[model samples]
Target: MADAGYVLPDEELAQLQKLSSDFEPETTGPLVGERQSSAAITTEYANADPVYRVKTAALPSKYAYFRTCRGDGHCGWRAIAFTYLEALVREANVGKFEEEEARLMSINNLFNNVGINYELIIDFAEEMFDLLHKLAHSVSSNDGNADAILLQAFNDMGTSLSIITYIKFLASAWVQAHPADFEAFITTGDVKTYCSLSIEPSQCELDYVAVGALSAALIKPAGFAFEIMYLDRSAGEEVNATVFSQPTDQNGMLLPNPPTIRLLYRPGHYDILYKAEDFPPPVQQQPIQVALANPYNDSFIPSESSVDIMAMIPGMYSTSFGHRWPSVPYEFDASPTPQAQVTPVQPYTPTPASAAPVNTSRQDYMPVHASHQPNHSNTGRHGLHLEGPPVTLPIHSLPPPPVSIERGHLTLERGGPFRPSMYELEQINVPSFQTSIFKNSQYNTAHYMNPDFQPEAWSPDTEYGAGHKGKHKPPAQ
Candidate 1:
């Protein structure tokens, strides 16, 4: 066996020898020399167990190959472990590892522990296609309108739940980020975080939430009609005109009507209309005139013909003069009576010798007659002469009497005691010759007896007229 063709090559035998020398047996089992010889023999034995035997055929060699080089020339332990895990996966039906599931799971876990980061949240949203797919599949499988409704409800519920969950998560995140604010909230016991968060909710938010459950129960799909009644407590008894209109689309056709909404008010409510068409016409009226009546008696008559009877009809009436004429006229006689003629009495005149000097300065003079002369022989001392009776004489034949001068004393004589003469009697001038002698005498007496008396001064030339001889007998001296 050593020299024949079955013998190994030198390099090969050397390699075998090296392998055998390096092999060491346990002390309790065998000696090193025997183990080496046995290992060398085992390299040739092909029928031995490869894992257990060190000699007999190539079992040891096969075992060394199996340990160092796995089934496909790789390590056997790692291969075996991988194969076991693979078998388990197949049995459990855990599909292939998905990157999307891992990503979704990571986001879900983040929100569950802390809060939703809106930035990250958008990634977990399903596509419209996916949503429609699920919805269609569910509808087809369930095959009922109720199922359709339920499906929509479920979707709505899901959206609501997601929103609510997100809100809760956000609250948690805020608390974590602001611990002081959280402590304040806890102390105050007032959870106004949503209101205080500065997120302004619109009218839709309030109304929708208020009517959410009711709306959900009543709302139906297409072809279903809804009626709702609303009582207006604010409306008064009299209501104005109410109006209803259908909101239109761009093409002018009415859009789908919203649910019917009713407004109830008091029956007698009157509404004032502002539009001209609703107004009524106004009414017209006519005017009337009144007349006054007369109250006087018909038998009573007025004095004047031009008087208005209508005016007197209302005045007082006189019954005593009713039958008598209102006015009367009287008659007068026009006759002349003859007068008797008598001889005129002459006026008395004084001779120049007896007469006092005529005051030429006196403007007023009385006319004298020849019957007024006193005899020249009847003279007193100092050329004084007695006054004869007043002579009835014609006014034109005698010289006008001297104008009587008003003075304190009368200068009757030049040297003798002054004697008052009734020269005023000769000075009297009468317009009528028929004047009574007694009346003339009375006037002459009044002048001589008057307390304030002054006799008229006579000039010597006037006393002795130009017809007489020069200064004869000084008037019976």
Candidate 2:
């Protein structure tokens, strides 16, 4: 170490300062991060220079979101690669993924023409193709998980490096193919030599020439526009954008409003940019309407002990049938086993005029406990003879509870939702026997107006046990 008192010469001091300025620390964080509101960019520059503060302040008004790319030397290439796949995902078309894979496969010939060895790039190309396959499956399955899958694949160091290398080679091959278009930008003038030394190297950052090549070779043909917004000390209130490619039709007519892959370019780093219009509105899930099968046939007769046949005959009884209850199928997640959907039971009002008839005999409609008996005082209504007090239906006559047999090994816990039974909903227009003591009482299940009304029953076992309690021994003897 140099002594504190020692003074360095001007030439040596200049060399040391240059080395220090050129050195960059190793990058950290995910290669690509989650998409976040671009207001974060403005906040990041709150204490920064006036130019940066002014530019970033106007950023969120136009670009609603920004995603970070790691500041490693390959960020430019990584940004473009990631955004290209993301744009395809935004398209939400399974066919587009296949089309892109085939187009990239054909580009192998370009590599061959440019003297890039097939074996050298095959491993990297395979990684790229594998991601394409996974994304295609996600779209076709309607999993709505392409965003998560794409983010994870890019975060994997091995997969990310392989894909970055693959694109670097692609850019190199594209540049070599069209010398006239890019030769002027190449300082070395020799296209082959420039690509070998700079464009195709694994550690080199992406440059203007390579970005243009990628735009033409990969993005434009995939029906996407390519743009880069330069945020710098440049004289502007907003960041300046340069459009490298705009998708066009076969007739060379410009296509309007194509999916775009935008990048926010700093002096030596690159991140992704997006407008509010980039994302489609979230799909509002309508309740899953399960169309029930046909009504029971005449041959299928109800047992003698079932609810009076008059109640089953629509318009004969004044009972109001509730709405068609929506039963939601379990929502399958990214995991192999579908996580159970725990939908809250919504109270449905029974529409009298247009509502279809629902089977009241289904177990979900049956009352569990027997306490309150059915009303039987109608004199001439519905052409029924007034019978003695309604009797309790026998337990054997009740249908079995509906069985929900899940396909996989998912063990449903008690927290899982169940449809609210007919007896569980509010009983409207029914006579209320509310006294001051019984008002809002949980123990009022016996009341006819109770939401959980149950028909009263006499149990033979309880009666015999109570009457013969003390005489049992003498009887046995």
Candidate 3:
């Protein structure tokens, strides 16, 4: 019997019992439910070969399109060839291969067997995608010669761009996935050997990958700042008006911008752009002179406080010197020292007005010494006498007058004969080699008399003489 409140139908009750049974595992063993089932589904999907799928989708499109399109024979053939090549590469890069045992395996086996990195396989996939996109969008409808040339150029550019993009992506992914291996390889500094297998020959191909990998390894982001110095040529001074940040793309290409600082003279305007990290520490303010002949082509010369205007330009001109901020050190020690000490002296004071009135007239003073007359006028009187030699004026001494002589003749003192000194002749010495040869007489006589008697005498047999010959003799000899 069923309760009155429950009102359960027979079919509905059976369905609920089934649902409960499914939710609860068999009590006899262990419970296996949705988690395990979901994992199995994910594994199956992941294990399915991606390369096979790419090729299956790519090849049919490659062949079917060319068969249907009716175009210029030459152009059509070219497009067909490019399509076939793209398909072949995509096929090689994609899908799983079946074995004789009918076992399924991951497509990675294809790349792995060839010693290709798995990430490079992905990059190749991406590269094919780009090439296919370009091929689909190509507009080669015009049959003119110009159109043909343009089409060829575009095709070449496309190929180059695609190849470079593929290499960059491949290197980047390999480095990222196998960081430890990449680090060990990079430490050798011969990455070219390791990378040569996968890397393209063009520098552009490797640029992005190398930059990205190095940026990650070094952990330094590239940045640039421009210090804009405005020059007032008339005033002969420069003012740092602003510092501008240069904009760069994620891939590190600089953006174009107008000149930050304007100057009266075009050549005077200078912009020095350098990496922020590479810039040296700021030192004393260095005055720079800029030549203004050609605005684009100018020269920079540094000076202390002012630059020579004449050096900048050949013509003479006055220069104005201006500085935004002086780089001089301003702080100093204020402690007192012995040499800098200050002394205080007492002020002179006059006598009080009430004490005395001093005479002001010149006649009030008396002389300290007076002439005295002797009391005894007789010649026999004893008197104090001073005895000393008579004082005489010194005679003025004058230098002798200059004497001019003829060019060939030598001047003498007043009038005297010129004579050569024996000391001067004795100071001269003859060379030892010359003295030795002269003593022997044989060598000196032949040297002086015969025009061909040479100091550097040489013949094939005795070319360098005994001294040089012995020094450079062959080991066997």
C-alpha lDDT values of all predictions:
0.24, 0.58, 0.24
For candidate 2, the TM-score is 0.56
Better of 1 and 3 by lDDT: 3
Candidate 3 off by > 4 Å: 1-128, 133-155, 188-477
Quick one: ranking by TM-score, best first?
2, 1, 3
User: Candidate 2 lDDT (Cα, whole model)?
Assistant: 0.58
Candidate 1 deviant stretches above 4 angstroms: 1-133, 136-142, 145-159, 163-252, 256-477
* Candidate 3 residue-wise lDDT, 176-221, digit = tens: 4455645654644444444553343333222223433422321121
| Model 1, TM vs. native | 0.15
Question: Which of candidates 2 and 3 is the stronger one according to TM-score?
Answer: 2
Q: How does each model score on TM-score?
A: 0.15, 0.56, 0.15
Worst 10 residues of 1 by lDDT: 285-294
- Deviation of model 3 at 458, angstroms: 72
lDDT of 3: 0.24
lDDT for each residue of candidate 2 in 1-477, tens digit (9 for 90 to 100): 576456456557889999997888766766888675564565455445656755775576567668888888889999999999999888999999999999999999999998989788999999999999999999999998998999999989899999999999999999999998999998874999999988888779999999989999989999999999999999865799999989999999899999999999989989999976787534221110010001111211223333333245343233232111101101111222111211123111122321211111111222211211222211211112112212332211111111111100011111112233222232231222111112111112221112221111211123222321221111110
| Clash count (model 1, backbone only) | 29
